[model samples]
Target: MENIQCFRPTKAVIDLQAIRDNVVHLKNMLQPEVQIIAVVKANAYGHGDIEVARTAMEAGATILAVATPDEAVHMREYFPQVGILVLGATPISFVPYAAANDIMLAVFSQEWVEQAAKQNIDRSLKLHIKIDTGMGRIGVSTRDELQQLYDAITAASHMLVDGVFTHFATADEEDTKYFDKQVKMFKDFLQLLPKKPRLVHVANTATSLIKDASLQFDAVRYGISMYGLAPSPYVETILPFPLRPAFSLQTELVYVKKIKAGQSVGYGATYTAEEDCYVGTLPIGYADGMIRKLCGQNVLVDGKFAPIIGRICMDQCMILLPTAYNIGEKVTLIGTQQGVTISIDDWAGKLETINYEVPCIITNRVPRIYSN
Candidate 1:
């Protein structure tokens, strides 16, 4: 049978079921009047953008948000019926392509608004004006700036100003003063504009969880949470909902050995066997986006934990497996099955990274297998 197939050192398994659940769950966290814009940028944080985007829309998302124009175009091409907004800036020269493809653009500058008006393209263009209340990044800084751009935008009937939004610099921080200030700034800017926007959004994943009912705008951008992850450190401590992690990484044992005392293992000869012990080699390593820092980490096998014993090489690594598990048996690197567990959060902590980067770190060379 194909039970004994080629085994790789590292693999990332995605749970689309959890993704679907998270989308619906996140949407429910907001009010009925609020809409959800699922942030699918960075390839849905490496959970496969095309797959996650389709799931997100079906689950509860009204619009799919991307960080760049290219990602927006990619999503638009793959899912023609879906609405896409390029949350980041698109060059003036690329306007025709964006309009022809019906991609929404984020306009923060008068220069870009003027360009969109001058382009005078036949197709309709959706624009979401960004505000720089406290993010210290791109967007309109003051109400005066927004009024000028809004006036120019409305003058051009060809362009449609669909929404006005801002980014929160510290929504996830312990202090909510900065985020509170941004809320006021966005509201004040809205009053200055002559036309009322169809949608007003500012909350990202972090702000989406806040208790401030007034902070709730017309919509919110759901990012890391859509992949069953929190946007920041305080989410679990702050939010009412418990976020479930949706990814598990695993591989199989390829070789086994009994190393005598004083035997050194792997590169740099750093690990020395202290006693007569069994060792195992796995097919995963840094090349597969398995961080080498987890060399001393533990993986689960045969309902017991095996400590990884030495420097992690590029294509292979060593694990101290028990005498019970045989070849072709499953290895649990980041999962809980058969009364064993090796959490992805634990793995991320060892690598000195966040849970968000853990998914992104898994290389595309490893195929993602989905589970219920």
Candidate 2:
């Protein structure tokens, strides 16, 4: 669907129904008692957070998870009553605001808990104890640390231990040795808690989809897969259910002209036409997150693949067309055109990055149009 307000030809189209379907499918695969914590961080992985969160909730997601307190607050504005969890560390100053807004925060250290307890807040602050089984990012590393933090939070009248969780370092990998170790460590941390919190989530999207059903404790943080993307190729090969991708980038050729042999194109004049072939200029470039590294990438044009040629400009780029194509012809940068498909994975492969970074890096300048 196109946005009437967007005058630019380049836009990112989002399929909200695909987001809904992904959540619904994940819900079906999980245990009946397990809750789906839809990870809508990074603006729902650049698909637009509020819209995806709504669709996920409608499809039975019970909670929303974000990477920062600001994101949680942003989500709270749109969803007044929906549960929001900050999956990352929070500033000591944000405690009062989080408590007042009923946003849950991930806590790791006893020092953080002590500092947060000092904040003069009237409402109870909900917290999820992050146990660092092996991620080496955040969370308490040992059972002793976990116990101290748990005790500190319990001692605070205005603080509540809402949940306890950990992140797996290699749930998406073929080798399960480290993954199994993380799982065991997380379980060990849980045992240290005098009583398990209401939520004991430990599985991320990869673990939830491919690991044992027992890992889906109370909830699973559904991130990349919720946007209809596999966490990795290993997980993709063994997915229990197919994911319907929600993001598609598109534009149109504003200028099409035949370049003579030996004629150069774009900045630095890197690409020169070896033969008399038509070169089409698209109204999308590095500024729109079609980075310079993607100059050699293929984009779908009228059911055929056209390679982007020359140095990508800030707001424009040239594609070496197979033949003479008229101006205003539709171009798909990351989507299906006719029967041909150009996926985010294609861009990832070209950029030598992961699929998660493809959509997230697409600048906000490119408006996202939503479709059911």
Candidate 3:
């Protein structure tokens, strides 16, 4: 086995400038008063949470959003003073933790309200209420039901309704009716409440792109678009500017050999050569988040497209390089060179999944190098 080189098919290049630039662009879209809740969840969509979070706040983010209380805790420990909100339900046991740290929680059920109230209310913890306008997920779902929770939270001196919001299921799709409906429901909640929250946000990245008024609150959570990735394929065609991909991945050619035609490669012998060609082995596979299903995918190498010619192994994969390619040549797994782009979109398309999950699944093992 080779003494695994550093560039061995397992590097994620994150562009800090792209992250900042995306925020600046989003800032341009918003009024001066509209604050941005930078969605740094899923390890900043696998761009490395702390790296992206610090960059986001430096670029005018007023708050940070995460999916779990644990993520909030991580943020609290890593980057203090930044407002962190757990955008989902939390158990009663963690209620004290949330209150203690002043980290906001999203309360959907009255049971959650009753539990939080049961806890000794010192000075009223900041809490955001999630309404299920149509996502069919964790949210109050109805104005009347929300009113009951609202009255209870209001009466409790220890729990202040800090914010009210909802999530959009298909805001990234071409249809806008569903998102508008959710917006109407959010507006209704605003009207129903005796006093509005200090922060009212429902619009995520896709909604922010299509609905200018969607950010009609103290803040809006900027997600995919904040990282310079398109909110959806549809938005790419209509967005005002070309968004640069903030992520790039690289893996260098480690071992290479010219295999004779008729030779099979890798576990299932998934690849059989048509002619004598060079094959480059990369020290990365499913364990590195490059799932076996992507074995047949194309990679940009030496200014040409090379195909992964074998079943991805535990920590190595084979790519059929062009005949002229030599050993030790660097390969671009996800990036642009000579005007050819191999982006997360390409990988997502190859895997029949969304771009969001593609980057998220990159996992934390791979080292992320930040740059301008």
Candidate 4:
């Protein structure tokens, strides 16, 4: 299980098979020639990158995309031949390492190419030109800037422009107004290119799943949906096939007690029992990525809801149990129990954030157990 020691009952379970299945489903949905670049950045969104990337390649992914050059270097240890694309902007100083490691970088400025070309490297530097259609992130904003970057990279003796892409800022949003605008601009930008690079990608998980598949130029960068969580509710409604969630958080009750009526629980006595009730303590807290704001949330015990009480401590939290339960009873924080289930979306709603942030914040203190 990836050498993840779990002396504590809390753990995150990752289903590698679900990841592979997601890749296969997306692959089947795309055209035969369109590749799938599995995004394994942020440690595969905190599901463990190496395991997820391997599963993706076995299931039909042709390339792996990460957020940083360090991530690309780490992935290279696991995969020597699989193409690795650094989706985020890389420092010019790191260009030599990327070239030596066979990592493709996302280049947006002529200066980066000029800086990279000066490096005394034997291997050719591969690059993916990023155009700022509407994301307002790190990308060339105009046709002139795009051409300049393209021409500069082409002029470089050791730099190879392997791909060109743009990110959609509103693809996951319900309204297609901005989404369509970005798409149109991306298409316009594609026309500006002298010729399409080896990879001409414009679609991400949201666009690929909900938007038109024809927009998938040469490949689709699959991230959140590949982890079995929908990019957005709108995308979930239109998914051509079902996605199996690959992550689950689980723990067990370490201590149990019955408190008298009017007795307060946790720090500052935030919650007071109206009547006598059984309270269960779990060995998991904000330190393990379960933030204190989740105090009023619920965890599953005996297939029933147990409302969390009081301020969540550094290494522990209290839950008002339906009744007295065994100290070793199982608890489901983000997974199925009997029939009921709590999803990352539920936690995202609690945090007022996206589901992608929910799993990614789960710290390394909690061991991640992997299974097929």
Q: Once model 1 is optimally superposed onto the true structure by TM-score, how far is the C-alpha of residue 178 displaced, in angstroms?
A: 1.8
The TM-score measured for candidate 4 stands at 0.97
lDDT (Cα, 0-100) at 97 in candidate 1: 79
Q: Write the per-residue lDDT of candidate 4 for residues 12-88, one digit (tens) a residue.
A: 99989999899899998898799999999999999999989988999999999999978988999989999999999
Best by TM-score: 2
Of 1 and 2, the candidate ahead on lDDT is: 2
lDDT of all predictions:
0.79, 0.92, 0.83, 0.91
TM-score, candidate 2, is: 0.98
Find the 10 residues in a row with the least total lDDT in model 2. 1-10
Winner on lDDT (1 vs 3): 3
lDDT of 3 at 237: 78
Off by over 4 Å in 3: 1-9, 324-326
Worst 10 residues of 4 by lDDT: 1-10
Q: What C-alpha lDDT, on a 0 to 100 scale, does residue 299 get in candidate 1?
A: 87
Tell me how far the alpha carbon of residue 80 in candidate 3 is from the true structure, in angstroms, after superposition. Answer: 1.6
